[model samples]
Target: MIELLVIPANQSQRRPNWLRVKLPVGKEYASVRGLVDTHKLHTICESGNCPNMGECWGAGTATFMILGNICTRSCSFCAVSTGRPLAVDLDEPNRVANSIKLMSVKHAVITSVDRDDLKDGGSIIWAETIRAVRRESPATTMETLIPDFRGIWDNLYRVCEERPEMISHNIETVRRLTKQVRVQAKYDRSMEALHRISEFGLRTKSGIMLGLGETEPDVIETMQDLANTGVHVLTIGQYLQPSKNHHPVMDWIHPDQFAKYKEIGQQMGFKYVESGPLVRSSYHAEKHLFDQVV
Candidate 1:
């Protein structure tokens, strides 16, 4: 088991009311968990240890992680395993569709670990998953948080053609910190990926993490860069180091700071902004995106 390093609260620290969360239990939560297990589906909630897992799962929603759990790139802040990963499960799309059906999910968020070893960068699988979900649960809105595809425009083009309700590709962090935090990803490449997706006239979205030693200016600049690419949605979450071996949190950003970032993101033209300490890329994602589209 990987040990996590948590920052101790300062002397003046007073627990913020917003940090309080309901414990995971109840029929709804168990039902969702059962469906995932029954279908052999993986969720970022459990795999990446997202703080919002209880709330989201209790609400009968989850961010499905397709392709496989093991990631090709080893980002220091991520809890997903780093390895070559298993071969693509060809029946995964149908299983995801079945799980969504069982949960009666009105909206679904599909994400994946980077599969650089795949010839199409797993684009074909992404398209197939979207199609499967659509076919099984037609009313469900779809969102995909995808990899950068190593700057391969053609691969991205194929995924965008599926016409998901929203397409998110996180920049993850500021340009300077990208190297230290996201070792294998390139800042410029991620920005370009967002740009390319937007160019296809898709509803593009991206996210960034705070408390990773990034300056305010760096965040603002990164947001501006995202806006320039015509991204419609933005998420800002506090970086909680998953394990002791992961990167250390530089600072604990207060809830007020997150609110300010939300304001900035909106003022900069993001149609929707989910910004807060507990916000993950797919946190409250269904409702947030639904509010924007409907």
Candidate 2:
């Protein structure tokens, strides 16, 4: 058996103050829960163990996970379950769209796990989901964070066909660490995915995680590469190991470093950069649609 190596248990693994997350609560939060439960929709908030689930749910926004909770890829950095995913639920698109309508969300975020088992990489569903949301909630702007589609342009074209306000494909980490961190995903392919999205004149976005033993220059170089691809927005966040079985946190990055990365990203000509210990791909994503940053 090929045994996986994990970081040793140490005091450094203890989360710092900057990483503290608020517990889910409040009336709006409960209402959102009702929508999620009643409609039987899956969300990245739960699957990805997002830190801002409380804050975002309290504000009546969420990143909906489509296809299924299970992923096709077994990336070391992701917490989403891997193995054989259940058959695709064809009705999920309208369910998610109607849920967004019921919530009266102003800006919606949608994402899906890699479904390489499917012929289209689940891109057809991705496109239909966007169309459903647009039809159900005409006033709601949207951001669609997507998989690499294993670099299939035809499948990618189906997604871009909807012309969502923004399209995000996370590089997840620096180039040198891509093999270990993102496993099945390639650094250049992800960049190319963003480049293709940019070609459509849609607002292109991508995010990278730190604390994976990546160097400062690696980040800067990644930013430069993303800029060259015409990516307009960027997000940087500290990587927290999902569990002992997953990838280990290499080092605890300071808040100041995140701040510096934000500055560096802005200097690189990105329209906006969300960098902080608690930031995630869709953190404060609603604001991204308005060209506003919090």
| TM-score, one value per model | 0.89, 0.91
Q: Following a full C-alpha superposition, what root-mean-square deviation does model 2 have from the true structure?
A: 4.8
Per-residue CA lDDT of candidate 2, range 60-92, in tens?
Answer: 677788898789899998888998999999998
The whole-model C-alpha lDDT of candidate 1 against the native structure comes to 0.84
Candidate 1 scores a C-alpha RMSD against the true structure in Å of 4.9
Q: For residue 78, what is the lDDT in candidate 2?
A: 86
**Clashing residue pairs, backbone N/CA/C < 3 A, model 1:** none
Shift of residue 213 alpha carbon in model 1, Å: 0.2
lDDT of 2: 0.85
* lDDT of every predicted structure (CA atoms): 0.84, 0.85
What's model 1's TM-score? 0.89
* Model 2: CA > 4 A from native: 1-11, 25-27, 37-41, 291-294
Count clashing residue pairs in model 1: 0
- Pick the TM-score winner: 2
Per-residue lDDT for 201 in model 1? Answer: 77
